[model samples]
Target: MREPSMPVRENAAEQLEERQSDRAYSKPVVVLDLLWDLAFVAAATAVLLSSRDEDPSMPLRLWIVGYALQCLLHMVCVCVEYRRRHNQVQGEVMEDGSGSGSGSGRSSSSSS
Candidate 1:
């Protein structure tokens, strides 16, 4: 008795390529992500502990506000990074698509 062979539902080569591209982020971005992680933890800790007015210089309200602002800034940074990488990948894809000179560039422009 023999089992039937099956074709791959997902492309292994594309998955590998995507993984490689994902790992190709610059060192600074990775460092920034780590710093953001630390900042988040610190901000959360500060917000949690500052409910009792541990710091006399700043009020708990100010700490909460600062934490909220930090969260907004983090969101903005994430959005900017995502847009930057998305554009980079789109540009690369466009270049590759246009390599054959089949007027695909015109279609992209017209679609935009």
Candidate 2:
């Protein structure tokens, strides 16, 4: 016997493709993010390799310090990007006259 067809199941692949095509960031930003991720991985690998060395004094300390600085720099960059994006979104919402302050409004309604 033939079962009923599900449109949701059939359109899953199309939906995924559409979402991928509708990226928020540009290609350059995506590429830069990938490069930064690779750099972080390389730095972490260097730190791990340094730990395995018999002489773990100077080289290990330097790698650890460098990794720490990388983490701090990444955090600052993320914070700046987040603030910029947040302000941009707020500006958009303000223009739209929605005036949705935060998630608090949505959460309260959903609970009711």
Model 1 regions more than 4 Å off: 1-58, 98-112
lDDT by residue (8-40, candidate 1, tens digit) is: 323445456555655655546656775776688
TM-scores, in order shown? 0.40, 0.39
User: Mind giving the per-residue lDDT tens digits that candidate 2 earns over 13-100?
Assistant: 5556534543534445655765776677677777677676567445666666677577657756755765665565566566557766
Best by lDDT: 1
Give the CA lDDT, 0 to 100, for residue 16 in model 1: 62
Report lDDT (Cα) of residue 99, candidate 2. 69
Candidate 2 deviant stretches above 4 angstroms: 1-58, 99-112
Clashes of each: 0, 0
lDDT of each: 0.60, 0.57
